[model samples]
Target: VVDRLNLQAIVPSAQTLQEQSSRMHLKKLKTVVTYWATRQIITYNVPPLAFIIAANTNVNTGALINLYSDLQKVAIEDLFNKS
Candidate 1:
């Protein structure tokens, strides 16, 4: 196996790799918040365009968005599990 590869792989620092993971988490957050917001809009009988506009503009979905954004900021990976 050693002789098969001619190129070296670049390994990024954990912090840099964590940034990518953090972005993945933030995207998951947005999807979840959108789900909840859709439920609320259904309850309120608001137009569907309202959700589209707010999400495009990156407007706050009240407390849930704030809380999840903070969660994404502070999240860390488990030492033993890569997932």
Candidate 2:
């Protein structure tokens, strides 16, 4: 299922992390485009180094909202429930 596929993707990245001496950590970057209630699209970019951590860690929604708020006005409900 989805979990297995996600794990398969993580293994290689985990090895890379170890080999890199743990100096680097994972981060997930997301980009969103919204058009005044006409359309909304969200895109996620997972760096190869991040796949391992992503498989295990839950993203912090509050932090993401704070990060993206500078780009535009972000509503908590819109982000969490996608309404």
By TM-score, the best candidate is 1
Alpha-carbon lDDT of model 1: 0.33
Candidate 1 regions with alpha-carbon error over 4 angstroms: 1-29, 34-61, 77-83
RMSD of each: 17.8, 14.1
Q: lDDT tens string, model 2, 1-83?
A: 66556544334433443443333332223432211122222222322111112322244534443444443333444455764
lDDT of 1 by residue, 1-81 (tens): 746743123233335434654664642334222222223211111122111112322445564344543443334323224
| Clash pairs for candidate 1 | none
* Model 1 alpha-carbon miss at residue 44, Å: 22
**What is residue 49's positional error in candidate 2, in angstroms?**
22
What TM-score fits each model? 0.22, 0.21
TM-score of 1: 0.22
Which window of ten consecutive residues has the lowest lDDT sum in model 1?
Answer: 41-50
Whole-model Cα lDDT of every candidate shown, in order = 0.33, 0.34
